[model samples]
Target chain A: MNEVPHLMEHIDFDTTFLVFDLLAVFMFAASGALTAIRKKYDFIGVFMLSFVSGLGGGLIRDAIFIQAGPPKAVTDSKYLLVILGAFVLSLIFHGSMHRLKRTVILVDALGLGAYGVVGAEAALQEGLVPLAAVLVGIFNACGAGLIRDVLIREEPIIFKPGQFYAAAAILGCGIFVGMVELGHADHTLAAILATLTVFLMRILSIYFDWQTRPVLDEDDRS
Target chain B: MNEVPHLMEHIDFDTTFLVFDLLAVFMFAASGALTAIRKKYDFIGVFMLSFVSGLGGGLIRDAIFIQAGPPKAVTDSKYLLVILGAFVLSLIFHGSMHRLKRTVILVDALGLGAYGVVGAEAALQEGLVPLAAVLVGIFNACGAGLIRDVLIREEPIIFKPGQFYAAAAILGCGIFVGMVELGHADHTLAAILATLTVFLMRILSIYFDWQTRPVLDEDDRS
Candidate 1:
């Protein structure tokens, strides 16, 4: 009898979306802060890395959305709060938290999937071409991690030989765009399916140790 | 009689701006491509790095400008053509060109100054706060080089304890914004003054071997 809103203290679609977005931000920020700790960065560096890792991709996506107003990452205070919270937690409990590798990987996968869907949806809403939408989705999924690695003076993991990372985002984004093109007008359903696809693909790729070789490898064989 | 336009074949503000922008793009792209060659990257990687180094800062600045349309680097054909032209030249003459280290340094300084002024002016036009405009100018001047260094898996030179790079941008941007705040509404004069300030400051810094230390260095001393 439509009591879900009352039971959840007036939960709505936007509220649910905000919850997922916050979850993604928290996970990404935690990972980034942990990396900073491992790298022995100072407090400022830790905070900066966490903030960028949590919001950098969304900022890039929003900036490219042409019609979108000022980037939410810059205008919204909540993003900073989330990053700061994550940074504090990471700094305090890093030793114990570092052992939860499996949990961290799972959370990271979920964040990637959610962000991919969010990016793709935003691009489509802005009337971007399908290919561009897919590209945006992939960027939203992996761009933060790339920035984090770069800031730590390491090669970006996605660009190096690694398990399926960006590829999974590409596949999921492609599926979402294809569904919309093929008359699936329900954004929620498409996003759910695409997110699930990316999450599962990323998990399985990690489990199976999938890898992609560089183009230079071919030259060596020849 | 006002014959300036006629003497220049109806050349307008945009045309002159384009000339400077193209010069910066060519120099930055050529430098990036040369780095790629030294790193032994594949052809595709060379082109990609060249494109990013030439245009990444402008893209970031435009993306941040709330009222600006889509980034010109993405929408304009001329930027891509210029990058491609630079890439070809670098690829063909990399060996001989690498010897012109002094010339490359001078050209890079010029590009930095030009981009700093351009970015500050854009931010001011878009109604950003003076501090934000100055920050944007510094970012636009140094962001591309940071990206290039990161892509090649090296510490960004600006971040290291080295010569004054970003500081020069800050000084120039500050001067431009300050002039504007003092009611000097002539954009052309402001830009020219700012550019010359950055150029001269950069040259002097290099010549004098100016340096700044990291915040953590004090802790080490204690």
Candidate 2:
């Protein structure tokens, strides 16, 4: 994306970090477009949702967590052009999406990890405390999906008792922040460990059917 | 709240403007708490929603539009303490809320006007374009309610075919920005006209049962 090049002009991002960020954006954009297709929204709505999902995390991160100027997604023109290319491809292949559910979930899991570490690092760069970093990290990882769900008038998976989606993000972000802030680990190593932890937890949770229940169930009254 | 005094020390806000901002926060916080109660959320849930509803607009504006330092709601202790006081008052009087529905609507209309102007001013101060300023203004007026609805597993009123709520906000913000930027009106005059426009629009919409229709209905296929 053009934003990536512009960011490179300003700051020397690590190669691995840049790759992860790009991958996360690509994967989330596909998911967002796919959601719009499923909801039977119009073409404009599809494009809008795709844009929102692709850039929502960074938008929230730059706006709320990092207190940065305009977010990269908004500044770069190529961002939408690239997203448009992907949108066309997604619409073409959407009929096959159900069959590709497994692959989709695997990639989505990786995006979660990428978003988690990216968010935490952004907050820490702004000198936020560990707790705040953790919250921001989770927001970055899942905020897009939440927004998409809200748009479609569905209960967000994060707030409802679905799987351990937000929990996995929380754990991933917590691990990274804790490792960096408390254990004084190196940035790269902490990020790697956090990503791995979240990815594994997400896959295993889906496999084992783990859940984040509400504070109290409807029938759990004493 | 303590944040107000701290802000006063930093910026010599006109007394009328300061009062509007405080009233907006107080009113939104009350609505947030009331929504939580309607959902039968526990005490902690009520408090958390109240805080979110009260602080969400400023948090979003600071994070997204202004790119300022940490938001006042988070930095000032008195923000939450004042919210807590109102939360207690709301819980005590929530039983009669139905009977007081008309009064509640009137206050909320005023809050929307307050938030809309406040948001536009914050964006303009940050040198954003007129379009973005209007968006931020509407977000300021309606963001807290959107967040509250999402948390409660409901579609936000802004997204649904409700009355002209966000329309009112957009008009108010647009008129204010237009007058200040194009007509060279004074800030105080622009702010007053914008607030009155939104307030009147909201109340009239309710009285006239105005609705925002979908682009295409389910049976409107060509």
Candidate 3:
């Protein structure tokens, strides 16, 4: 469709978006690899986790877009190379990376925002329902982290109370979808705006130690 | 394809296979709902887990079969109804069900076998590669339990050592695929044999307390 070409043109003109996408992949991969290393998984396990964490969300989204043909990750070699590079870097420099905790957190938040916009835009281009597009966007932003945490036998941090993780993505996705529906912005502009909104929200939440309260049991409430 | 009709014909002739398939759905749903209840999840969580555990594997398999149109679980209302029925039943009878631990275990094992045959045959009918068919069969049998365990924040029991869970399914799938490939058995006959093999193996393994050893760490070895 014209939407597909429009998206390709946008990416072709904005090489910065491509760069940020790759950066997001690297950060997500590194986070997964670090979790594996902390869990004392073997090299294979670490590599597997890194690959899944970097690519799983996009893969799921693509799977849902069955009419779009095979998923890009399956056909493209670049994704595999990026994940491999990230895993190697993490394996070799995990100690140093851990020392830069604050930096890593900030980069991860940026990656979250970038992924949200990218995912929502892709879904919208595919003509998904607006609500479905937003959900896909949120999944693209946070699904890999959920998979990573689950693989290591932890409840996903996003699903647990006391985290502002998925909420930021949801807000960003809503903004992008709303902008597109209202014809207020082009895809690229909407993506940029949505990413900035999510990034700022995530940062502020962390800065203010924002948290959600858990739902109490009926007995506890009584 | 001729294969699809052949599978449908087999199911139509032998209503027992259809019954087993439904039973598998119910058992898997019950298992998931019970896990959510034990974890103190809200009703929504219980329903989500039940639905996923009953249908996630087949949904994933169908998603991979992009050429096969929409996933059966999505297109067919029967799966949804069955899962809902199981969830309601689990909610009402969980206490009594827990008391019948042996019966629950046996039914679960039977479901595993039934699901293994059904998944492999479906994949084969879809003309998947033989190895891929077997893998799909194993996924169909074990994938739901893995998702259920993960949602509850536990390492998937199949991935952990000390059980012959997935191994039994693999053996059954291999037998079914091998028989069909060699032209030694028709689809219906092979499915029956495979199901019995898996069921018996699972029962015996549990009876004998079969286990697999964990990989020892290098530091531990030293």
Candidate 2, residues B47-141, lDDT tens digits: the string is 55676687788788877567678665544445555666777877787766678889889988987887888888878888999888888998999
lDDT by residue (A123-191, candidate 3, tens digit) is 767666565567568777877877787778777666545546777887898898888877656667677
The model with the greatest TM-score is 2
Off by over 4 Å in 3: A1-17, A63-70, A181-185, A218-222, B1-58, B65-146, B154-222
lDDT of 1 by residue, B1-222 (tens): 122333344545456567777888788788788777666665545655777788777776887553476666545657767887998988777767857889988888877888887777778778899888888888888878887887889878888877888888888888888887665545666667788888898899899988887778655865
* Candidate with better DockQ, 1 vs 2: 1
Question: Candidate 1's residue-wise lDDT over A1-222, tens digit each?
Answer: 112323344545456556677888888898899898888999898888999899878877787544477877668789779888999999999999958999989887877788887777777677666655775687778778877877787766665556777777878888888877665545666666788898899999899887654434334312
Q: Compose the digit string of candidate 2's lDDT tens values, residues A1-222.
A: 112333245544466776677778777788889989988999888888888888887777777666656776778665566677668878898898789899879888887987899888877787776666776687788878777777777755565455767778878998998988888876777787888888899899899997654433355322
Q: What is the TM-score of chain A alone in each candidate?
A: 0.88, 0.88, 0.89
> Quick one: ranking by lDDT, best first?
2, 3, 1
Residue pairs whose backbone atoms clash in candidate 3: none
Q: What is the DockQ of each candidate?
A: 0.14, 0.13, 0.11
By lDDT, who's the top model here?
A: 2
Error of 3 at A35 (Å): 1.9
Score residue B18 of candidate 1 by CA lDDT: 72
Against the reference, the lDDT scores of all candidates come to 0.75, 0.76, 0.76
